[model samples]
Target: MTLGFVMLVHTAFDRAEQVARHWAAAGCPVVIHVDGKVTRKVFRGFRDRFAGDPLIRFSRRVRVEWGTWSLVAATQVATERLLQTFPDVRHVYLASGSCMPLRPIPELCAYLDANPDTDFIESVTTDEATWTIDGLEAERFTLRFPFSWRKRRKLFDRYTEVQRKLGVRRKIPEAVRPHLGSQWWCLTRTTLQAILTAPDRAEIDAYFSKVWIPDESYFQSLVRNHARRIESRSLTLSKFDVQGKPHIFYDDHLQLLERSDCFVARKIWPQANGLYDTFLAADRPSRRVAEPNPGKIDRVFSRANGRRAVGRPGLYNQGRFPRQGFENGITAARYNVFCGFDDLFDGFGAWLARRIGGRVHGRLFHPDGARFAGAERVFNGCLSDNPTLRDYRPEQFLTNLLWSTRSERQTFQYHPGDTPEVVDFIARDPNATICVITGAWAVPLHLSDLSFADMRAEAARLQRADAAMTATLQSAGTAARLHHWTLADFVAQPRDRMRGIMHEITGPGPRRVTDLPPMRDLTGFPAFLEQLRNDGMKPVVMGDFTATPGGRNGR
Candidate 1:
């Protein structure tokens, strides 16, 4: 599939050239539009850099301003230029000079080829309660922001407040229903053509020209109203803070960038420590192992029916404090541990196994085979017998599992025909206590290395899976005592406390607490813990352990 890129850039001309060159090397047409406000020398420099390249073109300069229609105008000019210049272009991607490709160009091409009819754009109906931007929807669509507000922010603010008090508002065209989304998107050529050639294009443009931040809503509204085939997901991944400014990716965000499924990531500061080099180097093929085969398990479980099967109660030990009723039977404890990326869970599970003098089974789930391999070595060597490591994509697997269940009750009832072997294993193991540990509600496994936007999107899916699994366990009436752990518990502890816990689990050897990779974000951990508690599951804090073979005390 032939691809075309429209980059809207205002600064960092050198970095913009690098971006153009990278895409050009990938055999894709690149069209850049420099803001009209930039110096003539800046435009000349960019022109001279790509003077010899026919595939690289520049759009007519437009004086772009933030929170205005100028940004939309610039994007339109560049997109039209790209379409006119490359008749064979199948898809048009909108990006910025600071955006970097997260995956190889060939991989992106392969994905597009596999889904040619899909328009990778994020679009949400503005009127929906979920489409929130702190009341910007009403203010933006209803008010006229015709001037450059940045030039006199205080004056414009006062004027807007006065206008609001006066009840002055613009009438939205009857045919238009405002939609909003990320300004960046990758759309099919057919969709773009329809948008540019729409009979009401002039009317639509005129109406949005006076609206605030029209770029964010213009294309989304048009596509949602007119496109035949649209996928409400952007190919570009970006993170925005509360202030609405895009997160500037630095060296620290490399792991996240490498693990993201997005084709491109935005707001990367080229001047950051090795940031440009890191991404450029990643453009090469990865050295990780191939993913595991899920088909083998699928083939085996496809013949069973959806009937509920009764199973015996599983053995469960509540650690040192085995609730009053189970004090005498603690020795017969059998545990099944499920964890995402943290090795601490595996270590704690091993400790539990030793404490109860029972068998332990560890299961490591991730989409990346390499991550699974690393987790297997850590958990199996430190805890149970060769822990099962499988290259499983949680989003895909959980989605299928949820769909296979009969929705009459909130239970984990799997249809035999559609259930995977792993689910069946958990269901049939009536004697094992189940422990599920994840970074947070959004980050189930370390393999879920996704962009911030992707993580937010996946959080809802993860919540659904969690609910479904909880219900399934409840419906089966298994004796398995369920314990849920979130990374927040680990983060809430003092550094020294975490060190002691790590020493307790890892057993004082070559591996040190500092040697482990740093945890990404722990902001969501506490809330996730509360969620588990709200769901009626007792979550054991990782920092409360006082007994360790290594003789380290946890506070």
Candidate 2:
């Protein structure tokens, strides 16, 4: 499980030397590529610093330029050199001299060994919506810009604008769907080899040489097109501002850098002396190197179910069971039940679980339940002292929930109806049953909607999201039984009536009663209900709860 590194650097900074040392200490072979632009004296000084080290090798210098084909050429040179030198290297990581390891190298290597086939690269489709550069998708490949634009930035910008106005656009080569990504990545040896020795390598390189910022797109496009088991995520953490410049880390960002799941973080300024020591000191010890847990259920469930149950309990008790029911001695159950906020009817799921002899495992998304629970306790304490703070704002609660559960590194983005963790849990748990409770909130809906048209648009968006989620679940290869309980059907007398019913169902008193708004419209509800039915999920009004308690109800 040997790892290799291709460190691309221009200036022979002390930080680069430190980075090389770190990788070498981790038992990785380091291949350093000094930019051809650097002076002979500087290069000699760098080479002299690591004179007798067999693990370290220097690539043939390539004059690297920012946002040009030269950058890719330099990377290619380093990658090829590393492979030629260390043929047995399992994985090769492409990074810059400024990047520092966030986690212990052993842990990263172990994870890589576990996922040998997966390529850790962040890639997006060419038509990615979040492309920061204006006219990037079309202009990057279509515009023929001078390489000298790197030096004459202001003049080139005006020239580019004049060319655009003149309606001169170069057609991207046929059959090449341009994909873009971060320049840094960790790729399996097989994938890197494929990129270097690709059949269309010459043609692709020639085409990309004329493209703006070819370094960002060349490897990503080729690897995404070629790699068999690519995981679209980069292990390197980098922060980009509005202008698209990578943030230079200083002493203040140590806490954030420590919390990142990424193995490495980039653009550590050379001036930040002793920052490296601080990072090294805080690095966590590696976990036991072994194969990942075999069962898909075990992996996803263990991560999603939060840290509870230290040692294995009985097969039935291994799954999460409500504290109340387990304490009350309602233990005997044939099947496990996983319920979420939508499924809980004033804690009716727990009541139903006990009634039907099923163990109730709480929601999957609230993996940080304990954290939130502690925060809630503190909030309650504050309210007890100052009654004025007891505004009981639903929006406030929702904001807190999002903030509390948000991922430390990436933004917690999810489609409205897509709960992958929940879906995956049900798919893995053969004996598990899922109850999806659906209802519209009026207060939150009204607050969110600027007008009735906005409310309609919101309803349409939710409907689409729900449909997508339902499709995903139906496609999942699982025999687990699922039930959809629509609150609208149960209390259809009035719009406000359903809200009141939901309030009653999700209650234990003031604290249990959430400030969630009522449903904005009953229009999209029927479609979702019908889709559930079509997908073989039993759709029923809330009054039919008794008929479907536990695993008794089925399509």
Provide the overall lDDT of each model, using Cα atoms, as 2-decimal numbers.
0.60, 0.59
Each prediction's number of clashing residue pairs:
5, 13
Candidate with top lDDT is: 1
| Candidate 2 lDDT by residue in tens digits, 1-555 | 368999998853688998898788778999999999899998999889998888899999988878788888999999999999998798899999889886778887888887888887767777764554333665787777674575988877887888899988776655477777888888888988887887877887788888888877887777876677987767787766434666678887676566555678888977776668865653556754433222322343344233343322211233544442232212111233322232223444344343333223333123232112213433221222122232232222322333333332111112233333344433333343444444322223433536655655555555555555555446656555554434433333322432343343333345332333232333344444454446554443223333322221111
Candidate 1 on 28-73: residue-level lDDT in tens? 9999999999999878877888888989999999998898889999
Give all TM-scores, in the order shown: 0.52, 0.51
Where in model 2 is the C-alpha error above 4 Å? 133-135, 281-284, 287-555
The per-residue C-alpha lDDT of model 2 at residue 422 equals 44
Question: Alpha carbon lDDT of residue 294, candidate 1?
Answer: 25
User: Could you say which candidate leads in TM-score?
Assistant: 1
